[model samples]
Target: MNVHITLAHPEPTSFNGSLTYRAETYFKRAGNNVTKTDLYASDFDPVERGAHYKDRSNKDVFIPLGEQRAAWKNGTTPEDVRSEIDNLRNADLVILQFPLWWHGPPAILKGWFDRTFPSGGVYTSRMRYDEGYFKGKRAMLSVTTGAPEEAFGPGARGGDPATMLWPLHYSLHYLGFEVLHPFLAHGVQGHGYSYEDHGKAECRLAQKLDSWEDRLAGVWNEAAQSFPGWPDWDHRGQPLS
Candidate 1:
């Protein structure tokens, strides 16, 4: 399969960085084409402001969604946003590799969603949800967390993984990706806060890398995470009665 890996961490030597590298190497070795979008290395600008739209529809009033729609129609999309869109268009499977910061994706990745997913270009009101632009493609997250596994549960201190991940997963569903179960690596503390010796952490990380490879081997056969779509919603956007 053609795969695209988007890395959000600033440091290329970080755990999240290693995960993206491993994914690229594993897939390519398996004879699949892989593309890497290292957001930091590429110096991706995360903030979306009025300046991005040079051909603004209303220069005085900067409406984000309106500007995006206009930019897409005029083919005046910023080079960075255009590049990401192109990569996603060609990929069969898209993997987002990042560390969980404050229970969500980094500013870079979130801004990626904000900029790359042009309102009129990638999706429309009627063409969203299950019927989104990337209907046939697959997407999943490979995340790292600083907390231990025991800390995450329905009512744990680290917060429920499922609940924390819902907004992002739902966003993918909105764009028509067949979202898969996220691959999480817990107990991944940074240098100063590391709970284990350096050697032990390296060993654990190596083992996790192996597990990631195994997951990829069966990715195609895996069931996607189910989400409610138009069929399940009413005129008021509530669940159908």
Candidate 2:
């Protein structure tokens, strides 16, 4: 199987970095061809603007959706966008690795979605949801948080993980990727602010890394997390009751 892992953290020596390294080694050992995209190391620009559209449909106006559609149709899409899309096309599984910041993924990853998934080429109004472009592929998020696991719950201190991750997960669903349940690493702090002793915290973090490896061993056979599809909605996009 072919796999692609996209890492969005800035620090190469960080825990997020280690997890990516671990995945690269593990996937290769499992006989899967793996491709990696380190956003910071590669200097991926997170901004979407007129500058990216070299051969614009309308020179005076900068409508992102319009420009993307036109560029794709004209074979003038940005080089970076084209390359990322190519990587995605060749992969059977995609792993998005990052440290949760401001309750979501980094800006670069967000921009990756905005740019790489071209409007006219990859998705259309009637071609989305269950019938999306990358239908048979699978995707998952591996995220780290600085707060302890116990601090997270409904109305808890660290906020609800499910709710926080909904948008990112839904976006994958939009692309027709069967999204696996996310792998979360909690209480991951660069400093000693995670409310745990040094030795215990290190041990716990190590355990989490090991568990991640174990989890991925059978992830391909695991069921994709269910989400509402076109069959569940009506013409007005309301839930069928």
Best by lDDT: 1
- Residue pairs in candidate 1 whose N, alpha carbon or C atoms collide under 3 angstroms: none
Off by over 4 Å in 2: 191-195
Worst 10 residues of 1 by lDDT: 189-198
lDDT of 1 by residue, 31-83 (tens): 99999999999988889999998889999999999999999999999989999
lDDT of 2 at 3: 93
Q: Model 2, 103: alpha-carbon shift in Å?
A: 0.9
- Model 2's C-alpha root-mean-square deviation from the true structure amounts to 1.4
Instruction: Give the lDDT of residue 119 in candidate 1.
Output: 93
Q: lDDT of all predictions, in order shown? A: 0.90, 0.89
Tens digits of per-residue lDDT for model 2 on 1-241? Answer: 9999999988888889888988889999999999999989989998899999988888998999999999999999999888888889999999999988999888988988877888989999987879999999999999999888998878998889899999989999998999999999998888422458888987888888899899889878989989898999999999999
Q: Candidate 2, which ten residues in sequence have the lowest lDDT sum?
A: 189-198
Q: Residue 37 of model 2: what lDDT?
A: 92
